[model samples]
Target: MKNKFVQILVTGILVASLPACKQRPDNDAARAKGTGAPTIASTLHFADEHTTATYETAINKFFKNGLFRSGFNGSYLVAKEGKIIAEGYNGFLDPVTKTDSIGEHDAFHLASVSKTFTGMAVLKLWEEGKIGLDDDLSKYFDKFPYPGTTVKMLLSHRSGLPNYTNYLEHYNWDKKKLVTNLDVLTSLYTMHPPLQFPTGKRFSYCNTNYALLALLIEKVSGKAYHVYLEETFFKPLGMTDTYVFSLDKAETAMPSFEWNNRRYGLEFMDLVYGDKNIYSTVRDMLKWDEGLRNGNLFRQSTLDSAFQGYSYEKAGARNYGLGWRLTEVENGKKIVYHNGWWHGNNTVFIRLLEEKATIIVLGNKYNRGIYRSKQLCDIFGDYRQSNKTFQELENESSNGLAAGGSQ
Candidate 1:
């Protein structure tokens, strides 16, 4: 609910430069509600004169509406033809630090986005004969048994498991027993009952499914989840900086990023910065996107199976894959995507086959799930080039400790 009048100040500069010039635009009531909270000013404007970036109009409006106003910290990189077309960081930045400031490396929790790494690890394990997708979960762990669920069901989220671990968050479990894959599975017994629907009956994003899968990974690979990821995916992919939730690494985190909603004084947190967290860089993610396209992680035949729906069911039983979400288009481009959400962290990783592009955004704050996501997808699928009046944001921090640190 921002007045359109004064926001004009957001025009003509790099969208990324708004934070250094943070001054509430004469809006009293709006500032009070978000008093003392972080802020970011971002607006992506597309000129009507050009068309390449014109397809980005919807995304442009979203950035204008303060979608940038709410996040812990964030960074985004848009790639095309193997080059970074747009890169931005906002909020929690060091105001007077180095040209490359603290905002350069704030690490954030991947939350469920960690699932992607987990999923990738599992696929790697499968290649080594550690586990099979069709194997039943009951065979892997003995603590809490669900005889009917299979690895495929678990990955596809058809295990009928309701994210039971969420219930435990209501209780006071010591740090030793909170949020781990095992703790979540144990809490399932106390969480109401079994699945709301039958196995392979529907599709709902149940975190418990992943927690259990993590256990399956450990039991089969005989390797700790974090360690396994470090060895297989992180090391081999040259994504050395990415991790599950490492604490010592957090101390060296990059400064968090945000967008200041200029007129409304609305601040949005886009990326997550944390002590024990998932660490990565735009370069690393780009490697992943490319790997999925050219590498042979899963067999060609298995790749189809892994990305295709295991069964056809309506309602919650929507489009999904082994560890990815799949969508089919009658005449449009088919997409494979999945989003990760944990606490205030949000991430969306998408692959568009027809466009041969991948769009990934990782943020520290939460709350702009559906609307903002749709807007981003529109930009990816429809952006037309525009350089006429389009202004690119520049990073003001040159004192950052690791400005060019490869994550």
Candidate 2:
């Protein structure tokens, strides 16, 4: 039965990866009017029976002994060479109610991982000649306080803007009132908060950077951030179960829980979409990973910029890319990935770019074990000897020690 399940799963992934007969009109129009870049399909690599069984055994052992035993409540999917090798959904959508078990199609808040989409959307605008990466914030917003910061700086988290999460609460904004992207901007303008550091001096991983990037996307594209993402990436990629969270969808969205299984209530910061609030399933995230990998979404140069390391001021293997976190590993290879935490939600999205392996774990219930999913890199390639293990890097991020770590 297990072997049969693996075969069926692999076959389904193979079928999904193929080109569809019908394409969305807007997506086709965007591709034509935009980059005009050709899509490059990855060479599919299906593991043999023995290899597949080996992978399943190791993955099952890891989850059963590690995550599952530690009270993980979410879904996980592992893919190698663009093929689904092993996947599972465990626990309930609402732990308190003990109902609605999690499934493949359920979406959990991506937290900072949502930055990946915001970053790419800005780059997409850049590719279309609608915006320049170096354009100043003053160009878009009247009386913008930050003079030197540019679109590129925001994408790479080098803008040095104070984090809204910190300032909004510190300034004693009404806790009952939900904050929006524009409200964040208004507060920045009115308060004129001191910059964390001079623009472009260093990388600081501020949520305010991406929040403003979302506004930039809307200003340049003349579409709301959520609308732009849906029309540009999600719909085109067929990520049916993904979306930017809104109050209207709140009731239907999956609820997050604490480590003790207590459900977390919504807060003032919950409404903001760019810095976080993207809800996506593991499979939908895989489609996103494959979409970016296949070169169908943007020009090769654009994608390269998004994944390239931008911060070297600090002596460390971990660095921030445009919308992703990177870990420089042995043999000059880099693990391009992002992990997210917001409320009780923790998400892991990893891509071993060279080996074409992907690891995705989304848990509505907080579990530090979720970050350890990066350790699975060892199963795909020679990532064992990196200066810092992926697990350690993620641990820092989860504890809010790393820049933009605790999103």
Best by lDDT: 2
**Cα lDDT of model 2 by residue, 82-115, tens digit:** 7776555666777666545565567899999999
Which regions of candidate 1 fall more than 4 Å away from where they truly are? 1-72, 93-104, 169-179, 188-193, 247-277, 315-318, 330-332, 367-371, 379-407
Candidate 2: residue 229 lDDT (0-100): 98
Which whole-number lDDT from 0 to 100 does residue 53 have in model 1?
33
Model 2 CA deviation exceeding 4 Å by range: 1-51, 385-407
Q: Judging by TM-score against the true structure, name the best candidate.
A: 2
Candidate 1, residues 1-407, lDDT tens digits: the string is 12221121122333333333343233243333433222222332322213223333333344444445433245554444333434444433232232321122344445555666666667777877778878876677664556688888778788887655444544554444324455466666555455657777777767667667777777777777777767766776767556665344434543332233211111111121111235565456766766666754556665566667765667332377877776554434456677666545567676665566566676654545422443344444532122222222111112221111221
Show the lowest summed lDDT stretch of 10 residues, model 1.
Answer: 263-272
- Among all windows of 10 consecutive residues in model 2, the one with the lowest summed lDDT is 1-10
TM-score of each: 0.67, 0.83
- C-alpha lDDT of all candidate models, in order: 0.51, 0.77
- C-alpha RMSD by candidate, in order: 11.0, 11.2
Backbone clashes for every candidate come to: 51, 0
